[model samples]
Target: MTAHYKNIVVHLPNWLGDTMLALPFLHGLRSVFPDARITAAGRLWVSDILHHFPPLDAVASISSTSGLINYLRGEKFDLGFLLPNSFRTALAFKLGRVPERAGYALDMRGILLTHPLKLTDAIMRESMVEYYMRLLEPFADISEIPRIMKLYPDEADRAEARRVFLENGWDGSSKLVGVNPFAFQWDTKRWLPERFAEVADRLAERYGVRCVFSSVEKDRPLMEKIKGMCRRPIIDLVGKVPLKILPAFMEHLSLFITNDSGLMHVAAAADIPIVAVFGSTDWQRTAPWSQKATLIRRQQDHEPCMKPTCSRDFRCMNDISVDEVFNAAEKYL
Candidate 1:
């Protein structure tokens, strides 16, 4: 039997990719408590990601534990779903006096939770989307897990994307391919920039699709390196747009080729086909959650180590040839 809860506050994960993966869990929670008002709360940037999600009545941005507790106290939440396994998260809900706090029993915070779910190695080994959805099991029946995750980008976002496209000389008629070569904060996950350039040049020439390279402003140097290596014309829009417009811009693309990064998940949320390259990290745990996606990982003896940097020759990423990635992109185009 499902317990009756009138109001619920779900604390979201910190990272963009993980937050996107939690869409299924959020949807399932809504299904169980249809009448309940759900508030999705997290860091400012992460909370912004949930802005367009309909199930959430509001999105609260938290700067610190004390601020979060005060915010929760004012909201008078009946239930708290702490998606992040931080001890601080559990403590805030407890201090806020939320009647029931539900989360994984990790970080020695089990005693703080009204309902704590035990997490084992087997569960940790599962895909991240599945792992996040497991948190919903203790409270809701959750008979079916959603395979395709959902995100809602409003008309304004689409309009901004269109404005940027026209300003950049992109005609609405041409098939566009997006190349994302830079991974945020993880150098090990990045494939060779020259290789990415080579593949983009080949795909653009063969298919006649307008190839566009995108990255945050901080990654402009890397994007420039890739652009310098390219033989054919590739639009360099690195650092020009904001995160809110990314999904809508991604919607314009026929396909997205990228490393295992936050943008990969964003592109997946936009329902675009992807050719995601994998290296130090395991695609099984953090691959794009899209049926239209194709993953390119080298089959090495020791790979998917889940490391941020490689100590060895970095064969896992280097071994993957440009031809392999080009072939994958060709299939989608």
Candidate 2:
């Protein structure tokens, strides 16, 4: 690689928090090769989140397996980081003829790697970034783990968010707390809508804060259900808000109460105080990385079932009551 190494590719994770988790490693990559042009590729839903990441010299879109192959084939990248642990990611770089590629030797992708490092023993016990940083240790010794984070929002984005609040009749004079009850795109992962409504009602009554519900287009009905449960005048801004508006709106939030969803991850990245309610997910493994986040996990072991439908009823999340989350909200309120 020359002084101004032009092309570099990074594969980002699918989930929002995991995508942010890769920021430190992304920063490290930039530190090692300062002038290298960095391009990140991932799912379309992640575009909302990664669009705010400045480390990326540019962002690339890969819709299909062929698209990934074609994009990598087109760009003669000097180096690539396969942050997404998959055989296909490693193979894409190999087929694209990238000279230097570094990633964890996962899913037999080691066969395609120019440099593949083993996962650290502590990685299984620690956060996701530790797993990613381990890949870079062989290239250069990372003595102290860097506290890397990202929140890049344009002025237009902020203006749009303000417009959204105005459209919803929010004057921005009173305290506004966001509620995100829809989790991953799975029925079992969601906490009961009635329970969220109950909690929203309590927050409004106690804190004198208005509740603004947030969710993807598919989750509009879920937010409506919360609005139904609210005794105070609640403003429902679920499906109408655009992705670009999210970061700035989240910045203005007094606090965000949510389930294990992408929106929750976004709030944490924006350095907004968060009261995260955990159900089936493991707080230790996927807890909010921000200093201001307060993770409220039910004291139940063996809960993180990565499956969409659990054989057993979701006792872990179901056991978490409206009262528990309301109690945790007291500190942030």
Candidate closest to the true structure, highest lDDT: 1
Q: Let me know the TM-score candidate 2 reaches against the reference structure.
A: 0.92
Best by TM-score: 1
Writing each residue's lDDT as its tens digit, candidate 2 over 1-333 gives 336557888888867668777777888777766777888888776755567567777787678777887888788788788887889878877877788888888898887888887775667777765666676776667756475765788888888888888789687687988888888666655777788788888888888888888776787766666677767787788778777677888977889988777777678778888888777665676677788887766554565766676677677678878888888777888
Model 2, global lDDT: 0.77
**Could you tell me the lDDT of residue 94 within candidate 2?**
82
Judge candidate 1 at residue 303 and give its lDDT: 67
Question: TM-score for each prediction?
Answer: 0.96, 0.92
Residue range with the least summed lDDT across 10 consecutive positions in model 2: 297-306
lDDT digits (tens) for residues 1-333 of candidate 1: 455788899999998888888888888888777888999999876787677788778889899889999999999999999999999899999999998999999999999998898998898778888888887787665556555487887999989888887788687788899998888788788998889999989998899888888877889878777767989887778887777677788888999999998889988888989999998887888988889999988877776677787888988888899999999999998
Cα TM-score of candidate 1? 0.96
The lDDT per prediction is 0.86, 0.77
